[model samples]
Target: MTNVLQVIPARQGRAVRLQAGQAIRIVNTHGTQVVDTWCFNAADMGEFMSMEHLHATLGSIFPVRGEPLFTNRRRPILILEEDTSPGRHDTVIAACDVHRYALLGCRDYHDNCTDNLHAALRQIGLRSDECPSPLNLWMNIPVAPDGRITWGEPLSKPGDAVVLRAVMDCVVAMSACPQDMIPINGADCRPVEAHYEVLT
Candidate 1:
């Protein structure tokens, strides 16, 4: 049987898990940090983390109470189970990658979200390329009337967290925002930790 556990980032590490139907939650140990995320299925790869379908079903791009969290097939994967305000999260922002590095004028650093993503991969004993895109669950990006997404003011406070219950066993990867060049990370990315327990 699969069991739940608490994982820590320790400022430079990541918390990753291969939860098969077991629920898991990541807390923003510190407020205002973007949690770089990635996911994969222990079951399938083609039907992997699809954010487009998730946004379509969860209209205007935000999760709400009693709403079904989306899967690659646009079906419910995890329910919002608990949150301070479903409105406090953002599901549109894509995890930053090397290409983004060039776009963001960080060509000198050469590091990107993929670093954290790769870390997540290593934790689960997989390669970075084997991972799928992730949803910025509580990163708080807002859509302007012109269909533009702006980094909105953060809505999560210290100790505030998003809780999700897995409708199916799945693998997820997380980072404590190692970004340091974006508004989402205040250009000073640091670390965050997560704790999980099965909700029986």
Candidate 2:
């Protein structure tokens, strides 16, 4: 039996420590929800997962099973073990921040992925500045033939999940992506509950 470590709610964030050989399973409880994820070396905060490195290493935008998520230091941090969704996750988009909201014409304070990531990292004695761009799980932002990217609803179904195993001791942070302005979350902006499990 696997032990349940933490369960993160929609629009919220969580940070957990995973040792090498351990895995964290992220479940899309309601489907169509995007999970923004970040990883960092536990011993050295400066070394964290890098999307640019991953793309250069894999030569593809999407992650495949059995591939390692490379960090800025050119080290493997996590390995993609399993994915049940439609494999539409993204790596190009940056987490939403206050400036983004302002550009969208939102005057009031809005809950965003960047802030959520910072909050989660704070629990581990880290700050927002240390947070890096994340692996957008279940997100669908497809590039057109003209090289324009289009945001669309996620292809993940209810109960869809992805399991990633840590290759080294690291801190894993996640945000349920509270992007309400787009169809990424069904255009309702209502966040759903996301289930997380750390398996030994």
lDDT of each: 0.59, 0.88
Could you give me the TM-score of model 2 versus the true structure? 0.96
Candidate 2 residue lDDT tens string, 1-200: 58764678778899989999999999988897899999988888889999999998889999988889999888899999999998889999999888898999999998888999989989878764555779999989989989899988889999998899999999899998888888988667567768898889
lDDT of 2 at 167: 95
Task: List all candidate RMSDs to the true structure.
Answer: 3.3, 1.3
On TM-score, the candidate that comes out on top is 2
- The residue pairs found clashing in candidate 2 are none
Colliding residue pairs in candidate 1: 20-169, 21-168, 21-169
RMSD of 1: 3.3
lDDT of 1 at 150: 76
Candidate 1 residue-wise lDDT, 1-200, digit = tens: 33455554532435344454565566665566656555555566444555677778766466676666676787666666677634466566666666777787764755455677676567767664544556665577777789887765456766566666666655666666545555665434443454443444
The alpha-carbon deviation from the true structure for residue 157 of candidate 2, after best TM-score superposition, in angstroms, is 0.4
